[model samples]
Target: MLNRKIATSTAAVALLLTWSAGLTPAHAAPSSPAPTAAGWLARQLVDGERLETVVDQVPYPDQGATADAVLAFAAAGVAQDNATKATDWLARPQTLAAYLGDGTTESYAGAHAKLALVAQVQGRDPRSFGGVDLISRLTALQAPSGRFSDKSAYGDYSNGITQSLAVIALERHGTAPEAAVDYLVDAACQDGGFPLYLEQTPCASDADTTGYAAQALLASGRQAEAARALEWLEGVQGPGGGFRGSGPTPQENANSTGLAAQALRVGGRTAAADKAVAFLKSLQVGCGDAARAGAIAYDATGFDQGNATRATTQGITGIVGVGLLELSAHGEATAPASDCPITTTTTTTTTTAVPATTTTAGTSTSSEPAAAAPVTSNGTRQLARTGFEPGPALALGVLLIATGVLALLLARPRRAER
Candidate 1:
């Protein structure tokens, strides 16, 4: 009897572990990395519409991050419904006024170009979005040197990024001028990479700026400049396949790696792109936590909730293997499961049958043996079977194992007493 009890209990423990291993998170119904990252990003939006930033204890919509989310969504080709909501929010009058400026006192070159790109991605009219001709406004910021300057009372604050965005937006609109393309070409450093702030002394090349600049140059048909920038990016790639922003002591980060990955892929550097993707994947938070699953961490430290939005938004583009120039939304809504290692669990059942004996009227009589209960390790029960897929299944699995061990210990103690 004791042996039979032990066998049954051991089988139960194995069943628990197998169930836990097979348990799939409700939201993560098996998907690729791109869709999974995109889905996580979609959930980060405020009310499924926009991303927000808190300032002075007040929350305000962050248009730039929101635009980035849209771009990420397009790049991954998923979450089109949420992407539509975000794009709608960007097209709102007040949102446009705040982000793109009032058009009378302050108009930002980057903002204008970025939103124009967003509009184009969503198949909306950048010419008349939010009652503003985004293309015209963006073009109006261009200077004689072909650099797109910001029209603001505070300062010009434009740089390589602004020029890149302006060129991409104009190129996509089929109105990219030769001067604009030439200006971006001339901004390249001697090392064949672009700087974050053009005309800055020493012209230090930046990973992020070079990433965007390469894509822009490619879009404008500046193949030579684009090739040089791609080569520079490859040369500067870290040993672990990551990239760093421009700084004396720059650390490899997911944001920079993501941007660089997109550039390398689009620039036809297949080997470099593959390595970049691997680096980005290393920074992704995996299956341990369902809520943060598929989220790309900023760096090696870990998944940071505070900076996750930006990191994830930018990181997703690279993971999806696409740049902004080719981003589009045409994927399904299925959230992806992280590529977690699977541990195959096996269970063995030992059935000990003892013949049934009956005692009646002070006389003992032997009867036929009882049938063995069915024991199958491959039970269909799982966390998903329980209609929940949070963290409970893992905890419960641990508890079950502990209980089984405790049972074994208690059984041994009782046998000794006997």
Candidate 2:
């Protein structure tokens, strides 16, 4: 993402071509001053200034959620109080292993890797973060086959997420093991994509797993393997330019597309990368509610009520051409404005109300639905849902004004739920 460091003309030319690929749609759409998309993520802190998930009215600190909060802040260049608070919480000496202590259920190994990456991105030392030498801790967990795992006893913990994060985290400190690299490189399925669980050969390919594994393979200097995985991603790209999630349902969401976009760009598939980036940009909330601007949603649903915070955080990195691992490094992502993608597909949150129905009392119906009026493609109104209502249209004519900060508040996924 730090373009100023790349000296080659080819790299510079590529940056030029994709810098503004899909940002215009967001920029052109106008709404009142509101909370930036990144702002939505900052508000999720519960107790101890650390991230927490509610479980039966009890609050438990979550490493993954906290790590996500840090990445969200870093991606947006936000250096505000909340970001500092989260960083400070992470830096506490006693919190090191405790943050990743959910060995019974969570991937404790993966937590170490994610926090190590987070520390590095924040310009801290991964070796001694929270008074814990995570690099060493993670290294000790690597199996003879180079795959990383805590081998948690309660539930499945080892997966592409665990391996990929470990690979990337170790890479930042120049401690990545070659054997570990091979573990991911050789885990490729027959279809060229990677699966979350390496249960057997010829496994099904998944977007999230494949995306992370492709990144892991690329970081490990196994470009051939990474290329094959990337090729599989291209094969599954949706018509709207986003990549689909794994499994039979195969829905494309911000998380899947963001990872694939990063992998594609890193793999040297410029056009494909641009398209994926565009797809993500198209989902960004230009501005509608006061606090949802600059946030990316899961898909065309623009700020999914369940994914607004996590999705927007991850999506910002993709739009900047940096994968989650790369986000761990300290630098600004440089890009041209023209390279940003504009969204062509708009997901409607509401449809127009029927004109009116005669009341059972033999009088004209007087009440309109409590929901906001339905918006049209141009973000204008063919007619307000009712004759008395005014449309909520941004100057860009955003197809609808469904995005708002409240959506983010309601969308935060609690760690307890997992």
Off by over 4 Å in 1: 1-31, 55-57, 333-346, 351-418
Q: Per-residue lDDT of 145-194 in model 1, one digit per residue for the tens? A: 88898889999888998999889889888968788889999999999999
- Clash totals in order: 0, 20
Overall local distance difference test of candidate 1: 0.76
**lDDT scores in order:** 0.76, 0.61
Q: TM-score each candidate.
A: 0.75, 0.66
RMSD values for the candidates in order, in angstroms, are: 11.6, 20.3
User: lDDT tens string, model 2, 346-382?
Assistant: 2212221222311111112122122121222223322
lDDT of 1 at 88: 94
The residue ranges of model 2 lying beyond 4 angstroms of the native Cα positions read 1-35, 46-60, 93-98, 102-107, 247-249, 324-418
| Total clashing pairs in model 2 | 20
lDDT of 2: 0.61
